[model samples]
Target: MSTTELSLAGSQPGGLGRYNRQAADLHYVTSRVMVYLLAFTAVSVIGFPLFWMVICSFKTSTELYQFPPAFLPHDWTLTNYRDLFIQTNFPIYFVNSLVVAGGATLLSLVVGGLGAYSLSRFKFAGMRTVSMLTLLCYMLPEVLLVIPLYLFVVDLGMADTLISLIIANTAFTLPLTMWFMRSYFNAIPASLEESAMIDGCSRFQAMRKVTLPLALPGLVSVGVFSFNHAWNEFLFALVFTSSETKKVLSLGLATWIGQDNIYSWGMLLAGAVLVTIPVVLFYLLVQRRLVVGLSEGGVKGE
Candidate 1:
């Protein structure tokens, strides 16, 4: 204590404070630099594959199959894309994917939104059990459920149809939509809806007029989620629809990898680019709302 007091007394009051401030500033700067470094590293790792795919998509067949593959295209060409559209049933696949994904997203939103609202707003016996079951179903892997789903579809004689794909995708996506919307609906204050009801509006009208407007962000986020999930789904598309005309984008893309020298690598790369565009555009459109909804929902639910 005597030594400490002596040392403290020897140093100017302002000098110690200044030194401490300098150390803190140094530490903060170092931490910021480290964070930035990690972020850059992560981005580079995650983004490299997509970047390479785009690069390869532009490369000619000869350049693509080159022994020492060039990082940049030796001969850039749009031939792959031209062939993809002209030579393949890519357009049909694209439309199939769009229809299935869109239908699933729309259906998930309608059913899941109502279910979520009920779960969020109403209290009943077994509600907690039901919530847990919904989460459990979502947590289960798609592969595990596929066989039973296949048999069920077969029994219903809906196999090899777009309706089957829509039904399958909706079933899987609905639980997530319900849970996500439940969290979001929970975040929204009940007073807004109640006040509308107090103003001579029915509960349904109040929900339509007040709550739905406020839940737009959450809805957009869920829609994006459902659409993406449906778009990228391959297993169900592969197993359920064996017919060429009924195949979705993912199944169509797999055809590019032939057993012999029958397939076009360049066209496959081009297809990858084409497949990515819509999802990216959709994400960019509602990213702000998605971020807000997720953050608010996360905090409010817990």
Candidate 2:
């Protein structure tokens, strides 16, 4: 054979080579199919309960108790929602939850942000020990600290108040916030803040204007986490608060569960839906910032 023909023949795959290529292609396709299947299954597992909750909220009490429960409601009604608003103290619980969550989020952000900034920017004695301790505190179970926290609140004569809940939530969430924000702050260059300070801004001013703006994503992430934790917290609310007026949404919802039977599944579901909306909305609102923040952090790490 000519040299050109010989070279072309050598370059081309033989029968076994072609079969190997086919095998690789088959493997790739199978992997992709499995990945998609797993993704769909995970989404379904997580999303179905939420979907069912919303659907059942619209169901009638009679339909809710029906055997062989339907996936979708047969008789749609807003009675659950109406009763949640008019008949129950849901509005009060909602307002209390909002206040406590908001207050905790703000408090955690301020205290944790400053602490994180200090850890990131300054060299201090016991800094490593402090960081480790913070992580350990966060790792501790809520159940362990509930009694101590309740006693502390009572000692202050702040039990059964919304402020006590805020303080408790802040303390619990602060460690996580500090750890997370510290990482984010470390990812951000201190030179940026230094430059601001050199340009006539005070250290605090530089942090407020430059570092904080850059750390917006971290702040938003921790804020959302703190708010969600406080909002959904049942143990603290149950132990610390006593009065009906002081109850949060999580505590209020628990009252609907009678000893023998549920008071009203539809109304409870409706309240659950309402309780979930603010957290969802808050996440949706900050979704863009979160994506940007993650992308920026990844790029910085690289």
Candidate 3:
């Protein structure tokens, strides 16, 4: 063959090579389409219930009980919300939820922060075992823990109290808070705290002045997670509190549903809407920090 013909033949793609390239491109496009489809499906599944609840909250009682339920209310009204706030013990329940969730979150963060700092920065024996146990505790289901916790609360004479709810929430949340903060602390540079220590600062002062500020994103993420968890917790609240006056929103709203009686479907939906607002608002406020903190934790091998 002439040199030109030989070169041309060498440059031409083999049949297998061309087939492989086409297969890879097809696979790539198919994977992308499947990912987008799954994401859309997940959003619809999770978001539809929330959207429906809000829509029902605005519906009139007649429309709510109509033969075929309407997607959009023909007669929109705030009557449910008005009744929820005015007629029921909803306000008291809301306040109780706030106190318990807030107190639990505060206590979790304080103890978890210090515990995480110790685990990340110190070099004591059984440290690895302690870390593993913290993760195990967090991973365990609340159902498994509630029985013993209920008995403990009764022994302490704290059942049916808001403080008991707070203590219960804190006990469950503190483990996860410790795990998250431990990862975050691992990602932080130790030199920052060391420099503070060299400047006549005690260990606590170094943590307060230097380390804590650096880990603000992680702290915010953990705080929001703890608060949201406590807010949504139902089993602990149900087991701990009995009186209507002491009930949190979760337990209180549950009583609206019964075998023969639904106190008010409209008001039940309204309460659900109200229950979601604080958590959604709190998330929106610190969403950026949550994203950054979690992303950095992964990148840093935590």
For residues 39-108, what per-residue lDDT tens digits would candidate 1 score against the true structure?
A: 9999999999989999999998999888878999977899999998998899999999999999999999
* Candidate with the larger TM-score of 1 and 2: 1
Each model's number of backbone clashes? 0, 0, 0
lDDT (0-100) at residue 20 of candidate 3? 57
Worst 10 residues of 1 by lDDT: 293-302
How far off is residue 106 in model 1, in Å? 0.9
TM-score computed on alpha carbons, candidate 3: 0.82
Each model's lDDT comes to 0.87, 0.85, 0.86
- Please write out the lDDT profile of model 2 over residues 41-134, one tens digit for every residue: 9999999999999999999998888989998888899999998898789999999999999999899888998998899889989999998788
lDDT of 1: 0.87
Angstrom error of the Cα, residue 272, model 3: value is 0.5
lDDT of 3 by residue, 1-302 (tens): 36644554467667755565577679989999999999999999999998899999999998988878899999889999999888899999999989989999999898998999999999999999998898778768889889999999999999889998898888777987888899889889899989989999998899899999988778788888888989888999888899999999988888777621446789999998999999999889888776765554334344
Residue 300's lDDT in candidate 2: 31
